[model samples]
Target: MKHPSVRGCSAIVLAAVLTFGSGAVAQAASAPATTPATTANPLDFYITPASLPANNGDLVRTEPSVFYVDPLKTIRAQASVQRIMYRSVNSSGVPVAVTGTVMVPYAAWTGSGPRPLVSYAPGTQGQGDQCAPSRAMATGEEYEGIFIAGLLARGYSVAVTDYEGLGTAGSHTYMARESQAHAVLDATRAAQRLGNPQIVPGGPVALAGYSQGGGASAAAVELAPQYAPELNLKGAYAGAVPADLPAVGRNLDGGLYTGFLLYAVTGMGAAGGLDLSPHLNAAGRAKLAATDNECTLQSIASSGFLNTAQLTVSGQKLSSLLELPELKTVIAAQKIGNGRAPQVPVLLSHSVLDDVIPYDQGRQLAKRWCGAGSSVYFDVTAGATHIGGYAAAIPQAFIFLERRFSNRSAVSNCWLYG
Candidate 1:
């Protein structure tokens, strides 16, 4: 099952990726292509009426749908789009229902080989079912739909997951890493299993996400080596990764992210067994329920900069909620840097001045993963805020994906390889 090792990318600091290995040859052949895999039919891959899988990563079912992706910049009509429900495991390894969408652009593969696919994970929208990417993308109203349009313009197929429960009939697991990673990776598996010729059944694939999505992408890359090894993941681009849940929690507990804390605590509680009713006072309980249908604006505006200590019965910080044994175990599994090293290359970007997820945690992620022998392309953006860092990282992020999809090996700045 081993493929030949391609040449590695140049370890440049803040420069666009240089031509490497057979990339130049591949590019010289056509618009852009890579090592192709075998062709397939829809049923040849997916199991219909997909019975409950005993395994962790599985594709449940898919139904065709329209994607109203009219971004600020318009592109050709979508060739195909589907609303898919798949099977994935939570942080505790229990099977859960996950939802997402797969879209193919009007652009066709003009290259010598098949087209590349990018499995994109959107950052926090909200805990509400209305905030799901598939729901928003349907109306061309999703904030990130414009960005997705850009990917379609690049002539690559795209698959986006709404994570488990966000768009479905349950509470979102929020920051639970395993659930997030399973949803993202399974979206790719579901797309390929659909046997879309535009997807290049065996072509190179990449992962991209920012913030919560970034953390999910990091988890996907680490888990990809085992959970879904059927994929040929070439690279992952993660922006503002929340590598340390403990650190992130301590920072957000008494700040503008009070609603997010509620979401995470309640989310993990729902997934695991941490009940907040014992810890939260009556007002806190009411606020949490009132925000059930609230989107980002509503959640942030209502709970911003508030301290959880005032809402709790003991009047202490929300961090105390993590004192429970099962909760601590789930949160530890959600931490990103402690997992298996990514077999593929990874691009990690973070703003040095991020207010939400600390910049130091991102640095720690790179250092620890590099120490574990991961090829990391670390970019520390200057002056930008948490969201701004995503914009700053996009240009080079594409370069990273292009080089990887073109069949090049990735070089690392992680030289402390002892």
Candidate 2:
């Protein structure tokens, strides 16, 4: 994911494409016990707190469906896909509706223990219901069609979360750390409880994501010990993780990538129910309203290089949003490093030339997690920008997760660097 430049175009849609092509998961808060028999419409529902069950991460329902994935030259015929509705907590710890896809490979476990699960989180797609992967895939237009195909080809069951409010009612809590983490972790539980032949309950599990997803995977690592301790999590591979949102906002303030910054503002505000009309001038208000229903690519194409200061009544840049008295705490709370170090071994990768998320922040995150005594294998790869890091890190992440699922321990790299 390059900064708000042309790279934002691809990065913005990364999550939407990855999840849609991989499988489908939809919000079913108002649906009956049984899901409708088709993947044609995943967003045909209304969500209310009264509509959600009391249990956190509980499986609300499941729609048995086919995965609209690319050609799998080898890996176990195509995997079976399902649209799932699950319960999860929001930033405020309230039980909220969440949705995502689950894919179970056809091949049985022939290697060793119970078949392992991979919780896949995609990068930023946008802040609209239309951006939901399940809805997009059902339409046969999911991007990154090949990314998830490769994962299924390796014989792993995958679960992808749409996060709170993305497919349901209310605003999407786009980068809220706790909410995203809960969605990722709960989606795994939903998959385990699924009444399917493919899922192996109490099996080893691994987490993987790039860019925004990478950050969520990292958040789940720290949160799982308390939030979802029952999960048999083995390890996580987070590449191009965005540990510092404030720094990102400042960096992209007046640049070509301000679209991401704009998305962040609207997303965070929507989650908090903050009427940003007070802060934005006519231009800012018009831009935000215009991009509300659009996905990342459209958002970028229309709102790039436009200065955030010009949109504000006070002529301040994106930093103005970061500093809003009501929003400051929320933004700070979204940072990832201060939390407990995830007990599982972590494989973290970042590109030296990453323009979207700073490389230093990734390194700083590794250092913090290491200080907290977590076993971390940090990689600083070269040449690739933020989005390109996915291709580079994924192949290596595959090996790292493979060893963990096989119950192998990683030699601690912290001792050498610390």
Candidate 3:
């Protein structure tokens, strides 16, 4: 459906975002790593049941939990929290258990109708089981906890997915878009089934995320219609979405964020059951093995700026490896935008100078969505790096959700691109 195009975010918002751009970028580099205190034990909650649930999103288990806004675990959100394991399918269409957290604020819902739910897809937390957001949030170490708190403060219950394998028995399907989408949508389903009076089963829902989370949210939005048609999905906020893996991989080659590229390659390989060992030399194999239990901070600290050529037997960069016939098909299947256009309104934001996740690819996604006649509000910003772009989009993203939940009309800016 073609929604009317309206004016983009005003100049004041852009100026305010720019003011914090540099600081946000600096903060992104040193984002807190999950402390050892949280990972000492193998939590049984993440273990898949011997018998799987028959339906997707059916709750496997639930336990009372906590949420913290700081590393000290002092500042907690004024909400009820639960760590949950639910049924979700993986990329190969096999049923797998996914873990996540569902939080509902204690404050009364002052918004119109039932309180809205934000099915939040979290940005990368690393591939390790201990790096799961549910664990990090309990220890007050989750980097995205602040954003989840923001949603709670707005009286919007939040469901944050750990994605496949993050807290489970297998390797995390890092950039495998379909699996991420399944985890996200099922997280929402699991949240509603928790029987919270504040969050009605068919209540308003919005997908929100940045970076990996952005890609997951984007994928979930595209897949929601067929995967979970009963959801009352309102709109989605996907910022700095890695819509094209090849584009993103090429940009990250030999750069400061090469860790992300490595994560993608290793993750896709694990998810697709491809044996990358043959192509990798000793250094490459060791590097890939290193990520088996490491989180984002560890990966970046250890692997940043290291060229993939040094790790490959053929001395080809990681970007080149993605072009292999077997790998190319896997990566191509992960690409979003060429498939279904979202049925609801979408606020697709990107920074022109995003140091991570190239900008042009994001614009191309917007253009493609527009061509497919989706309701798209393409919000363009300037001078923000990857993290900065995320910081800048938070307020605007929340506002976009507010408008949608309030039943306010969202005008698309798709015409501007044409």
Best by lDDT: 3
* lDDT, model 3: 0.82
Give per-residue CA lDDT, model 3, range 95-201, as digits (tens): 99999999887778998799999999988877778788887887767776666766776778899999998888788889898899999999999999998888799
lDDT for each residue of candidate 1 in 273-335, tens digit (9 for 90 to 100): 566687789877887776666666567778888777877799888767776677888777777
Encode model 2's per-residue lDDT on 1-418: one tens digit a residue: 1112111224434553443333321111112233237534334432434677667868887776554532221212256678888888888877887878888766566667778889988777766677776654444344543565556666788888887777776777777888889999999998998877667778889998888789899998889999989999999988888898899888766666677788788767765667778888888888877666667677667777776788888888856888888888778888887867889999999988887888888888988899888999998787356656666565677788778987887856776445
lDDT of 3 at 324: 87
Residue 78 accuracy (lDDT) in model 2? 55
**RMSD versus native structure for model 2:** 6.4
User: Could you give me the TM-score of model 1 versus the true structure?
Assistant: 0.83
Candidate 2 TM-score versus the reference: 0.87
Model 3 superposed RMSD (Cα): 8.2
Clashes of each: 1, 5, 0
Error of 2 at 348 (Å): 0.7
lDDT agreement with native, every candidate: 0.72, 0.73, 0.82
Query: How accurate locally is residue 326 in candidate 3, as Cα lDDT from 0 to 100?
Result: 90
